[model samples]
Every structure is written in structure tokens, then in C-alpha cells.
Target: MDLIEVLQHRYTAKAYNPDRRLPEEIVAQLMAALRFSPSSVNAQPWHFIVAGDEAGKARVAKGAAGPFAYNAPKILNASHVVLLCARTTLPPEHLQAVLDQEQADGRFAGEEAREGQRKTRAGYVALHEQAGDLGMWTQKQAYIALGFLLLAAGTLGVDATPMEGFDAEALDGAFGLTDKGLAPAVIVALGYHSDADFNAKLPKSRLADSVVFSRA
Candidate 1:
């Protein structure tokens, strides 16, 4: 596949055809792609909540009410919606969990490698904690996963809209995310674009290459 062609074809879909739904097999792969997205120090301090059913989507749509009402219909009409959340605090148990998963997945060569990995990750976590930036740092990492998912969706020929137009606290409450130590960072609505989506036909706009790229 021509990567540039895929990129050219992708855009922020304004509306989705509610009649269309992502196939379960494709959805499964997208989930896996999100799971494998990169994160700082392999902390992986994020949680992805998938909403494919009508009821579930409606619940998520609640966050878009009030000041965020403009986003409600997109959330409801999309075939699937994913809530990207970041850990409120990366406590010891959380870091340990990452280490444990790494070990279980045979990511370590031996005890020395495992210990080294743990120490490096711990130091970074400690730095963030000391600076009172743990939450912000984790939220930044969550966006990296968001970027990965967007590109992956484009490659898979799925239309996607990355959104930050909802009330984070409301979303957290609706999904009981804060109780799980996660805070809503962003949302993505995925599906096929509607035939009436005028944005699809508009030319893509970007800064001139010289203004965006530089060589040292």
C-alpha cells in the first residue's frame, strides 16, 4: 500500500454513517494496536475503554452534554468510541504491574536485565512525581497512543475523529474511571464517514514544509 496515499485519504471525519459498523475482526486488531502503542519508559500508564454498543455509546455521550453537546451526536453516531484515559497517579503498585507484565511476556533476558529495567523506569517515575507532573506526564503518554491509533485507523481504511470536546470529569464518572485511577484524556469516534460529510471533500490544509521542517 502507498503510505502517502493512505495519509492523503485520511481526514478528520465530521460525521459518520450510523448504519455502518466496524467489523469485529478489524476492531480486534485496532484494540491490539492501541495496546502495543509506545509509552515513556514502557510505563504504559493508560487505559482504553471501548464503546461499541448503543447503550455504552450513550453513556459516554453524557460527557458531551452541557458545554460539550456539539460532540454528542458524533459519539452516538460513530460505530465505535474509545475513551483514552491516563493514570491519575503512577503509584508503586502500578509500576510494579508493568514490570510484572514485562516479565510474564519474557521481555527480560535475566535477573540483571529485569533489575535494570525496573530501576530505569522507577527513576523516571520518581522524577515526575517529585516535580508534581505525574498526571500531566501520563496524559502526554496517553496522547502518543492516540496518535498511534489514528494512523493505524487510517491504514485500516477506517474513518476516525479524535476529540477533546467533552467534560473529562463527567466522562470519568460515567465510566467509573477515576475509581480505577484513570482520568479521561481524550476520545476517538471511529467508523465510515457519512456521504454528506462535506469536510471529506475539502482540501487538506497544512503549514508550508519549510516552516515545519528544519535541519540542524
Candidate 2:
């Protein structure tokens, strides 16, 4: 299907068929999409934890307990769940690591090019740090990846539900993300909708283009 058609039909599935599992090939494509997601200055300050089995999903479901109990079924029943995480801090070592990977990937023409790339990335990181929004900035980058994953799922005829109603603190503790310099930003459930999914029968609703867009 075309992009327009996919966008028009895609909806957040409220219930999933637990028996359904995504093909390994499709899961690989989705992982690639997340890995290559664009971020400002190519900061790539994000990590993804994907749960594809019963036990793995149960661990991710821990965050959905108590006040977030409503979302537990979605996580548990879905074929897979992805926990999107953002870096808690962007230190100099992380910047160096990015630069080193770029160089190893042949992204530089020479040492001069490598140095220039390093300086540019550092400048942006410093700016965010000075603004006292480094953490927010990283989280925004992770959301960009989430958007990519959602669109990729739609194109692949997969039902995806991007959820943020879980308890982040609980999730971090469950995953020991803090010590790893990471924090949970969002979670997404992927699978085929079940017969009980009432949302499948609903019409899509959104504001008119005129109200949401500007000519300027």
C-alpha cells in the first residue's frame, strides 16, 4: 500500500491476538528502522529494549501495573513490546563514541573532516547543556525514533500502539536503566488486533487541515 493509504488506515490497536507473532524478517525490518531513525546532530542518544516472548513481555508489563494496569493487557497480549529509552546525560565520552563510529563508518573524508564533524556535534551538545534541557533534548530524539517505528509498522501492515501511560520510575527500576545512564521515554505494543478490539471498528478523527496548518 502507498504511504497515504497506510497513514489513513493505521490506528492504535486496543487489543491484540496473543497467538499472532511477527515474522522474523518483519521484526528485523522494524529494528533497522529504529536503528536508523534520524536525530538532531545525529546524537543517537537513545536505546530500544524489545520484548518478543512471554517472559520478556511480562518484564516490560511491570511498568504497566497499578495505575497503569489498564495498559497491561495490551503489552502482555501484543506480539512484541519495545521500550524506548533516552540517555540521562550526554557526556564527553558518549560524544567521542559517536565520532569514533562515524569515522569507522567512512563518514569522514580525512582527519580534517573528522575533526570538523566532532566540533559541530560538540557545539550543539554544549548549547543544549547550557540551556538546561539536555535531558529533554535527548527524549525528543527518542520520540523521533518512535515516530519512525510507528510509521514503519503501518507500512508493514502491523498494528502498533504507542503508549506513554506507564510508570517511568518503575520501568527504570525494573530495567536498571538509571545505572546505565538511560531512562524509559515511551513504550509501544505491536501485533494484530483481536476480535475484541472495538477500536478497529471506529472511524478516524482529526482536525481539519485548515485549522492545523499555516500557509506561512
Candidate 3:
């Protein structure tokens, strides 16, 4: 299907059919797509841990709970869950791959990627910058991951919900995410549909496009 059509038909799936499990290859493809999502200067910072087993999903659910998550059994009961991660340090393996792309795409103009570097160094260099800048930067990259994963899942017919109605601190502790030097930026539960968890469905409320534009 065309990208626009795929988007038009897609909805946030709050419920999932537990019996369905996405194929391993498809999951890999989805994540690979996320790796290429744009970020600040192609920092491309994000981590993904896909938990296909029930036990793992439950563990994550317990740690992260928000008011709307009640009755989200289909989400909790889905066959697979993905823990989207942000880290203090970028992984070496992931960095080298992007550097390879910069070499080919001219994003770096034959700079910084010449060596067989396993990782590229990136972060906010201005220590004096306000904390808000860092916060915005982190959230922006996280959302890029969300966007890519959601679209890829829709393309592959794996319905999912981008869940933030949860406790991040609790989740990080429960998952022992610190071991990997990462923490959850979001939780995306993926599976087929069941006849439960019908929520958040309504016409999207938005200001008119003109209201959001500056026509001076």
C-alpha cells in the first residue's frame, strides 16, 4: 500500500489479539527502520528491546502504570512488547553503521567516518545550556523512534499502541535497565486484535491548518 493510504487506515490499537505473534524477520525489519530515523545531526540515539514472551511483557506492565492503562488488558496481554530505550552512551555497533551511511550519503562530507569506527561521538557539548534543551533533544529522538516503529508495524499488519501512560522510574528499576545503561522512553505493545480495549477513538481535535500557520 502507499504510505498515505497506510497512514489513513492506521489507528492506535489499544487492544491486541494474544494468539498472534509477529514474525521474527518482520520485527527485525521494523527495528532496522527505526535505526534510520532522523535525529539531531543523525545522532540516531535509541534502543529497543522486543519482548515477545508473556512473562517479560508482564514485568514491564507492572513497572509502568498510568490512569488510562486500566482495562488495557489487550495491551498488557499482547504476545509481544517492545521497550524503547534511551541511553547515556550510544552503542558502538549501531554508531559504526550510521557512520558508514554518512560516508555514502555525504552527510558528513567525508569527515569523521573514514576510520572503521564502531561508534560516533555525539551529545550536547554546551554544558552551560539549560536543562530544557537536553530534555527536548531526548524526547525528540524518542518520538522519532515511536513514529518509525508505529509506521513499520502498520505496514506489516502488526497493530500496536505507543504507550506513555506508565511510570518510567518504576519501569527502569523493574527491568533492571541500568545494566544495559539504558532506560525506557516509551513502551510499544504489539500483536493482533481482540474484541477488547476500545479507547482513544474519536475525531482528532486540532486547530485548523491556517490557525497553525503564519501568513505574514
Report clashes for each candidate as comma-separated counts.
Answer: 0, 0, 1
Per-prediction TM-score, please? 0.97, 0.98, 0.74
TM-score of candidate 3 to 2 decimals? 0.74
Q: Write the per-residue lDDT of candidate 1 for residues 1-216, one digit (tens) a residue.
A: 688888888899989899999999889888988999999999999999999999989988989989889889889999999999999888889889999999999999999999999999999989999999999999999999998898889999999999999997788778888789988999999999998888999998889989999999
- Give the TM-score ranking, best first: 2, 1, 3
Better of 1 and 2 by lDDT: 2
Clashing pairs in 2: none
Winner of 1 and 3 under lDDT = 1
What lDDT score is found at residue 130 in candidate 3?
38
lDDT of 2 at 55: 95
Q: Any idea what lDDT model 2 has?
A: 0.94
Question: Candidate 1 regions off by >4 Å?
Answer: none
- Model 3 CA deviation exceeding 4 Å by range: 65-72, 88-124, 127-132, 178-180, 197-216
lDDT on C-alpha atoms for all candidate structures? 0.92, 0.94, 0.69
Worst 10 residues of 3 by lDDT: 119-128
Residue by residue across 1-216, what tens digits does model 3's lDDT show? 998777766677767777777788987887787777777656666677777777778777775566646635755677677778876455556566667776777655344445523232433423313343544465568788889888988888777778777777777777787786676787887877677646435443558778999878
lDDT (C-alpha) at residue 89 in model 3: 51
Clashing pairs in 3: 17-192
